[model samples]
Structures are given as structure tokens and as C-alpha cells.
Target: MVTYFEATLAQLSVHRVGNKGLNEFYSLSDNTLRIEDETLRRLLMQYFLSPFEKAYEVFRFTHSSDDLNLNELFHFSSMIFDDQSAFHNLSGQITKHLFNISNHPKIKSGELYIATFRDIQLEGELVDAIGIFKSETKESYLKVNPEEGGFALSYEEDAINITKLDKGCLIFNSEKEEGYKVIVIDQTNRTDAAYWKDEFLQLKIRNDSFNKTNITLGVCKDFITNKIDEDFEISKADKIDLLNKSMKYFKEKGSFNLDEFSEEVIGNPKAIESFKNFSREYNEEFDAGLDQPFDISGAAVKKQAKVFKSILKLDKNFHIYIHGNKDLIEKGFDEDKSMNFYKVYFKEEQ
Candidate 1:
């Protein structure tokens, strides 16, 4: 299991600065910038610089500049950056923000580069990226031969390697449900990019209320899809109808009422009894408190909308959507038939 750290940015400052030696690859003019925010800088050092080490993962923004009108300097995105203009702007912004973080303990006096590329191959995909790099050195002992005697150890500092990049943020221009998503790495000595890239960065981030909604919705989905199916001998059609009804209840209402939902969704007394047991098990299994009321997550419903469908593929000819009114569709068998026939009725065929 991965542990998530909480961070609070107190204040921030942004400024434009001249690029010292980053003009060759970036093609950026003196329009580069440096930001100075002590609280944010300390947070970055504590959370990221104090963690493991690895080269920063780059994500390109794929959205057009027209869709990237964002007023907030720090916006969250679900996707990665794949656009040149967007990635460049994002890199410039990151460099400026990182400039003001001078007094942090872990972040020594060093040069931070915002390198840009037209298209680079990452994870088998050719995309644009703005690489964030920091230049620092580690203390090392160099052996030197003295004219009078044997070799003596000389103290020297070696350039810090990119193998363990502990503190940096790769802000991609790609827009997600929130804003532009960034791959933030805070590795100290241990390098584990996969955990940060594949798992942590992929999580949905928003306000507390938004997160509560998604968590609640996710719990419901898991319970219906896994728990209910395991213990009960309910048909697929009934399950789908029940799921649709539950989703409808969540969407139409402001909050979730446990007892009311159990009565209305399941309807059967025995099933409600079974669901209570399932609810207990579900809470334990998923670490959720579904017995309490929570505001529904509209964003989560929109995101998980496709997964809630119940489809029937008939000989690859027609796909049926049995989302509601399970009684309207009858399941019948044909003699020596490999598949069951479904008699569907609709008020309007359209």
C-alpha cells in the first residue's frame, strides 16, 4: 500500500527571469521566470526533496491552447501534456515558481533547468515535454599521489546525477477533469518512479467534498459489482437494474440515506437483510462508512458513467442496454440453443 502525504501551500510569488544557459534546447527568450514563495518552497523540500530519488517523469499536454485558458497558476489536470506551446508555458511557469525556493534545507544552491523538447519517446509514445532538472553535487574523496609519500584523500564535490531526482514537478499541459495534471516526484534515496507515475499521479484530486463524493460512489460501485454478486444468486439483468436504480438515487438526491436506499433499491425484505450484512462486509473490505449519509459525487458519476452499463451482445449483431425496467425484458430459452433470447419492450423504438 502507498501512503499519501498532505500538503498545504500558504502563499506563492511568481516573477519572470532571464535564462542563464538554457537557450540552446528550450528556444525560449529572456521570458523565463523564477518564483519566490517560502512556505511553498519549504513544503516542496519537506515532501519531495526529503523522499526518494529518480529522474522526473515528463507528461505532454495534448489539449489545444484554446481549451487551456486557466486563471489559476496551480491547476490540477487528469491528463499529461503533449503540446509544445502548452508544455513550454508550463515549464516556464514551473521554473519561475521554483526560483523563489532558495532557503530550503534540502534544496541547496544549484541551477534548475526547464529543458524543452519537440517530441521525445516516453513509454512508447512520442510526445513533447519540459524536463525539470536541478544541478547539485555530492561530497566525495579523491585519491591523489603525493610527491613525498603514498596517496592522500582529497575532499571534492561531484556533480549530482539525475538517476535519483528527489524533488521536482513535471507539469504537463494536458487538461483533465480538474485542470492540468502534473507528475510530482519527491524521492529521497530510494527510486520508485512507477509508484508515483502509475498510481499516485493517476489519483483524482479535488476539494474535500469532491473527494468524499467519489469515495462514496466508488464504495457503492465496488459493493454492487463484487460483494452483491458473490453472495447472492441474482440474475445479471436484476443486478443491472438495481445498479441503475442506485445510481439514479444518488444522482437525483443530494445525499445518501442508507436505510431508505436499502428498502427502495433492494425492495425485498430478505435481500435488504442480506444487504445489511453486505454493507458491513463492504465497509470493512473497502474501508468505507456507507451507513452514514454523504453528498453524491456528480463528477464521479460523470467519470464512471460508462462502467455502469449492462450490455448484451447478440451474435455480434445488436447490443442491448438493460439499464432500467428489468421486468420489461423477459429472458427465455430456445430448444438446443446456445444463447438465451431476450424479449425487450420500449415505449418508443427511437
Candidate 2:
């Protein structure tokens, strides 16, 4: 949760980074941008910070060699954090580093903005943060104004939309030794080599309650939706019931215990054993460090609950939403009409 209602853009340095594989060049700004307009500063703040409001998973900068000094971005950002006077020079070095790594042809060349913020509210504390943003795409806007009793229209090309931030990251200055708490957004080049996050920032997901809860919910959904059907004869309603039960357990309990969840949600011994096997495979395949008997994150549950769909689609005609007891729903076949149907039992029609 990041809030910037009272934040001030202390310094900004803009630079142009081009694709290295295409033989393009990068240009650096000589000095920090002096933004005198309050309106523009507010809009810039909104553009850079709003996308992080829903970003729950935190990350920290990492290096393969396990040395922070080898990570150029981390070293440069540390320098900037240590001495504000070196911001512009360090931003130039950051731009050069990005240019060196932008060798992939698919990477777009855009203006890179290195900004420093003050008084940002993060988890109830007002901390200063460093922001790095790049604008890869632009939109065309038409402008119409009155010209001597007549309306004249003009168009501007290559305009950055303030609402859509292409790529950005906020580095809060709280955790210095552990590679300051970071949150990132990458709306462009997702399928490419992950140059923004992996190559440039070299970030690794922080191991915390949010990640644990998120990974556990993901594995549970995968097992219930995809894996269980292979071993057992289960109907759509039964699957929905299982999903509902899983959601109920997470919502009711403050922490997660693997054995307890399996016993409660998946009662059958065979099914519980199958679920454990699948969980192990999932954890190994994705390197999800799922800790047993860890606290569950309510925020993670709220975010993941959206994908636990309960809708059962039938042919082109009807859809059934199963949220409760599976016993109430009965599957039947009509020989006369040569069709199948579900007989739903309910107390009253809503």
C-alpha cells in the first residue's frame, strides 16, 4: 500500500535510452529538471505512484554472485540515497546501465525518468523513496481551441498518458542493508527477456506472509481445478464445493496448516494424499517456498479470491453458480429430449 497525497517530487532527471541491438544511442540530461508548476508535479506524482497502490508483493535487489556492489543499479541507487547532490550524475550512470542491457531488439527506446520523492506514506510511515520510470509507448491527442471566433484543431504526437505508467519502480529507503523494500510495475515488454525487473533491477520476491499465502492459494486452486480430475471421478458441482470450502477455511483461519487444511477441505484419505503429492510437485516445479503453519495474509486472500470461480457453464443456454452444499445439486439426463440437465434444489427463488 503506497500513498503519495502529501509527497513532493524533490528531484527529477530525464534521459533517453535507445535499443543497443538496433545501434541506437542514449542521451543524458546535464542537470535535474526544475519543475516549478505545482499542477505538473501533482500529475507526475499520480502517474508514477498510483499504479503501486495494489502492488502487494514486495521485492529486493539481488545478484547472482551474492554481492550487492556488483549490481550496478543497486550501487547507483545507494549512492543517490546517500547523497542527494549526486542524483543527476548517478541518474546518468543508471541510464548508461540500462542502455547497456537494452540489447534485445524487442525492447523499446524511451525517456527514462529518475525521480526522488519525499513524505510518501507506506505502511503508516512517511518515508522518502526513489522512483525510476520509462515511457515506451505514446498516444496522439487532438487539441481544439477558439481562434478568433472560430475553432481551430491541432494534434500532438508522442504524448505520454499520465494514467498509464509503462514501467516504474519505487525503492523505499527503510531497508538499506536488506536491499530497500521495492515495488515495481512493468506494463511493457512482459514477454521479452524481463530486462526491466530481472536484468536492470535484479529483484527477487521477498519471502513473507503475502508470498506464502499467495503461493499456497495458487497451488490449492491448481490442484482443485486441474489436477484432481485425473485421479477421481468428480463433477463440476463437487469441484465448486471444494473451492468454496478452501475459500471458507482461508477466510475463517488466521494461519495455514497443510495437514489441517487437507483434513478439513479434502476429507478423503486418498484425495488428501493426492493433494500432498501435487503440492510437492507444484512447490518444486515453481520454486515456491511454501512454509507450513505460516500466517495467512488477508490481502492475498482477497486478491486471489477473484480467480476462484464458482460458475458452471452449461452448453449455450444456462450457467449455474454453485457456492454452497454440493448435495443440493443433482445431475440428470432426459432421454426424451436427448439432453442433460441439473436439478437444483433450493428453499426459495431469489
Candidate 3:
């Protein structure tokens, strides 16, 4: 969704932010780094923006007070967007804000990079974007060179691997009022110390086609796997069939209609009604404002399809992958062995 083929890094400021809980302090940069070498600039661009290529889900900054100006990052980013001259100062403020939020003892101190890019291709438009990144993990690299008759080898420790970015976010300057479209990646703090996105960014998933399709598929999966068995005497093969049908529908159709999906995927009247009720309950519980008859996101379908279990494990012996034609596979119990088994029928072998 985001491309940097023609993008150029305009400004870059690096700072060191430490964990407040550990009594560490943050150090601000005196001036923005002027990258003179074109090769290093290109590599840094790749390192910063490459992770966002597959990031399709968009997010917007939100606040508990329902005020955009109240959000610190949003306001600071807006100021920087409005006036590039204030980039260094605003970037320092952003780093200070991050330091203030690093109260958890598990949070690691790292170098924070604030960069501004130009001509970033997002969706179909070329827009400038502000990037914030932090490097938390380090690696060791060995260097070898020709020295006299033999090659000398030396190693360097505590080196930042440009390939593995720890945390990063890109804020495109397209939608200024609505918090500007944002995409983030945080690979380090995935556990309880999830302050990077939740406490620091304060972002909410944009209610777009991607989120709707993702949430809809999640609701269907939960209803079929966990809730349906409670009310209906459905077999595991039937569940797999339903899941397969759901995936097929999403893959085949560009748009999603609840009524059509119910009629096609869920044929039973009572089951369809139960599914609708369960969907409503799920929406209410999670506050997922899913709109009906919305366009289906292929990326979301592709991502959610991975988690839809199509494999049926038979004890510890065989695993039946029910992809199509549930009727071809029959479940039965052997009398002598007293063990349940699955009978699979196939037309040809690959």
C-alpha cells in the first residue's frame, strides 16, 4: 500500500530516549542529520519504509476527550507538517513525550529517529509523510579486510541491524484534520509493555473496508467454531465446510452482503437467524461498527484465511484437510477397535 520508489528523505533527527522507570534520561540531537551519501540515504529509506509495504490497515490518532488537538503526537505532527522549520524542535518534543510514556520497567532504551519524506506513494496519491522509528535490538557484525598477506577479521558489538527495524510509524500528510493517515509497526513491544502503539500513539483502527471485512470474517469464524456447536448438532466436517464456503465467498466476490452470505453460506433458516443474532451480539460486545453491503478487502481475507483451521485431526494418526466436498469425507466409529475414524474419498492423487 505504501511505496518509496520516488520518495526522498528531507530531514532526519536522531535522539536517544531512555526508560523513565529505570531512572534513565533522554538526549536530544543538536541538529537534523544531513545525509550526504546517496547510498546510505537509499539504505536508510529502505530500512524505514520497507516494513510498511504490506501494512494495509490504516489508523488515526484518537483521544478519550474526543478532541484531536488534545493529542500530543497529533498536534506536534501537525505543527511539523504545517511548518518544516519547526521539525527539529517538534521532533525533540515527540521524543520527550515518548520518554514520559516509557514508565514500564520492561521497556528498553533505544535511539529514536524522526524523519520527513517527500513524494511517498500511498494508495494512488503522492504525499509527504513523517516517520518515527526506534531501534531497540542490536547485533554483532564481523568485518574482514585484506591486511598484508592475510585477511584480518575484526568484530563489532552493539551494532544496530538496519534490516530488522524494532519500531516505526509513517504519518502521511494527506488527511490533516482526521489525524492524517497513519501506519505503524512495533515488533519489539508485543507483550504487556505495549506502550508503543496503545499508550504512545493512541491510535484507533480506521473503519474502512479492510477492518469491516476482517471483523466480519472474525465474527463468522467465532460463531462457526465456538458458538454454533452449542445450539446445533453440527459435525466438525460441517464446520469446515462452512468455513470453506465463507472463504470462497470472500475470495470470489468483490463486495459482501450479509443477506446474500447468509443465504449462500448458511443455508439453514434457524442457523442463519442464530448467526445473525450472534453477529449482533459480537458487534455490541466489541463495538465493531460493521456496515452492511460493504466492499471486501482482499488483503484482509488473505490474512484471516490463514487462521481458519481447515485441518481435522484424527487422534494422533492422521490429519484430514477438509477443503472441499464435505460429503466426500465421512466420520464413523469402528466396532472392533472402538475408535472414531474418517473415510476420505478422492477422485485423483496429486
Say which candidate scores most in lDDT.
3
Error of 2 at 55 (Å): 1.4
Candidate 3 is scored at a TM of 0.94
Candidate 2 lDDT, tens digit per residue, 143-224? 9999998999999999999999999999999887887889999986467949899999999888788988988998899999
- Provide TM-scores for the models: 0.44, 0.94, 0.94
Which model is ahead, 1 or 3, in terms of lDDT? 3
Please give, for residues 216-325, the per-residue lDDT of candidate 3 as tens digits: 99999999999999889998899999999999999999999888999999999999999989988877876677536889999999999999999988777888888888
Worst 10 residues of 2 by lDDT: 283-292
lDDT by residue for model 1 over 1-350, one digit each (tens)? 01113322221222233222333221223444333776745544343333322222223232224343332233322111334345445645555444433323333434455544333332344434333545444445565767666666666556444345544554433344444444455444333333223322333233333445555566566767777767678776777787788778877877777788888887888778777786777667755556677776566566566677677566788888876678999888888876679898888966
TM-score of 1: 0.44
Which candidate gets the maximum TM-score versus the true structure?
3
RMSD of each: 18.4, 1.8, 1.7
Q: In model 3, which runs have C-alpha deviations exceeding 4 angstroms? A: 285-287
Clashing pairs in 2: none
Shift in Å, residue 31, candidate 3 = 1.2
